[model samples]
Target: MHPVSTPTVLVDEEDRIITVLAGRPLGDDWDEVHAEISTLLHDAGPKVGKPRKQERRGDYTSLSFGVSYGGGQRAPGNLVQGECSRTVIRDISQTKAVQRAAGFMNGCFAAYAPKLYEEYRSNLSQLFAEYPHLEQIFPNSVFPTATFNCGPRVVTLDHVDNTNVPFGFCAIFACGSYDPVRGGHLILFDLGLVIRFPPGSTILVPSGTLRHGSTSTQPNETRQSFTQYCPGGLLRWVAYGFQPVGSAKPALRRWFEEHHDERCKRAVGLFSKLSDLQQDRQAVFSLKGSV
Candidate 1:
């Protein structure tokens, strides 16, 4: 594994930060924390039956709680807002272990991608505040949903999570005992970058917009990943005044149509560039910051 003393930022043509390869910032106790999370996952086991083509290998558990859209229904019927918990870790002990891991990754997300993290927190707060019934997997976690790639061998195919918020960032935390150099490298096809991902490291990336996956672990090695993200449908629900687009008033619908492009630009603007990282960090970590 390449020791990363500082974060490696990837930017697009417009200098918009697309990915922030956050290094191992878990401090001296990283090994202990990784072991605890690994043990929790092993005890919980795989929640899914078979490996899909996109997943390549190993089973996964998606613990989601938020609004979702587009499973092929008519306009108004398509959008649905509610809890969808497919998590295998249900015991109180297991839940706490998972939450601890999530908290660590959230801290890294806040540190590396301050602007995007801030927007995520604001959007999440607004969604939950307006709709009190929505279930949050972890109270401290900023992301609305989380997925545990429970793996004796967890490797994925290059694909984009199109259902996730396009401009939003997803936090991925690597766990288990895997050799970073031999395998377990993060591959970003769109950016043409292959990043050596050491165990206990966290990275924040625009998973919905980029094609990404990881390399396979070597023989006798194990790799697991925990990922957190928010579904795009929830944001759309907020934008449409907490209702499905089809049911929204005509004036509201018209406004959305007219301002869609402007909204997209603003969403893109939330990403912090490399040059602005210092200022963004200060803004997010200041005493009066929103967090």
Candidate 2:
């Protein structure tokens, strides 16, 4: 393991690290990628909206930024439904957004940042081997699309990504500077680890194992990051509904029922408590049709 620093590298026995030598310029190709991102943000700006704040009640973290690119129109809506409570961008052409994102990523890799990109590639390759489902949705190249957001209000709570597929996700931190004291570092809950990223730094994580969140920012500071989901194997296609399952709904339902039984129990308890209160009170209440 490398000694910790403001910008440190963490490599476990199974982990890999890639380092980009300093002093190398990003080169001119990045200019084009930057321009395309700017255009996409500008065109998709109107639809970018803020998420509604709600009490945190789940075991997952909130998403601070969102972009409706790649896969389909599902990204933006999924963010909202997932209770990210903030959408920095939305409703852009998924294909265009991904192309620009991939170009930017490639540029980053070609620069002295080859080490970091190699680490990212290695992580993805490993994840693919473990989760064959990702191969179908991600193909050979993983070009994910995303948006950026940061502010005192922009927040992602602590949580981990679903582990149904194999590959871990890589996020490129773009746009703004990150201050450790400001609580913008990525907290790895399980390891009691925190990574404070500098602007343009990329972080690779085993999405399923790492529970992470962005701490609150400074009053005026903003954190911007772009996330890429690298599907591992055939499971990725199944997860995205790209492949059909014959009469698997029952099996899926049973799986959820078993895994989520605790959650269901909690909900049931809450419902029962509410019912008891209603019965104990003599207060007149309007009856809803279904109830």
Candidate 3:
């Protein structure tokens, strides 16, 4: 039998965050989600195959487009290039087909993953309640958004959102494979935590709090997942479509600065002790700066 569950909307006093694991498998709504995704893909039309070539050490480009559905019209926007090769920005409310797709996806999350959805809603509400400044800009609980990152070997460079509102984000992995050997782990740089989520597993991350990215994949390996950002404050609404901006930048910068200093001190101490272990050999000097 499933364990007695707590109200997912309540925040943990220790971490001041809310996280809920659903009691049921997301497969309960898999058919509905799949159909909606299929319709959206069909409306997206034929994707012009284009190889995403990396232009710089950390920069890669891909072709993408936007799907907007609202007021009984399913309008497909012109294809545009993005940082990832297989990315596409889908605007659900701009097209009837997309609106249906969004509704289906939202329903799946709310029904099959009610716990996760509740946590997301609770966290965002709490954030806005505490940070009244954010509500002034983004009064809506949900933000108008589009996502364009989904493909094999897709790499999103380390970055932060461009808003001051506290937001909760989630990524539901639907990729069929459950193997750890597959390159689909979500890496959280700030916490040094790597999460390997199998298909049907949903991860709730405190957006504007964590810096994360995905691992690279082998050839012929494709990964599928859905990511959504829920708004918490007014600033979030005002900053929509501008870029990800927030206090996270300064916070991350400070963390890295202090972290590097600590690492330097440790390295110096380790090197001094290593000299004794190596009989003060000149050969060990070459490995001193390795880390």
Q: Which candidate achieves the best lDDT against the true structure?
A: 1
Higher-TM-score candidate among 1 and 3? 1
C-alpha TM-score for every candidate: 0.84, 0.46, 0.44
Model 1: per-residue Cα lDDT at residue 281: 88
lDDT of 2 by residue, 1-291 (tens): 211323334543433322221111244454344344444443332343434554241222223232122344322122233322332232332345444554444443323223233334444455445444332222223332233432213456776765312223344543343354555666778778765654344554555456677665576654444555433322333343433333346776567567676744532232112223334222212331211
Higher-lDDT candidate among 1 and 3? Answer: 1
| Tens-digit lDDT string for candidate 3 (119-170) | 4444445444554433211122232233423343344555444331233444
Q: In candidate 2, which residue ranges exceed 4 Å CA deviation? A: 1-9, 15-47, 53-101, 104-141, 144-153, 163-166, 177-182, 231-242, 245-291
| lDDT for each candidate structure | 0.71, 0.40, 0.39
Higher-ranked by TM-score: 2 or 3:
2
**Per-residue lDDT value at 135 in model 3:** 23
lDDT of 2: 0.40
Where does model 1 exceed 4 Å of error?
A: 1-5, 46-87, 92-97, 283-291
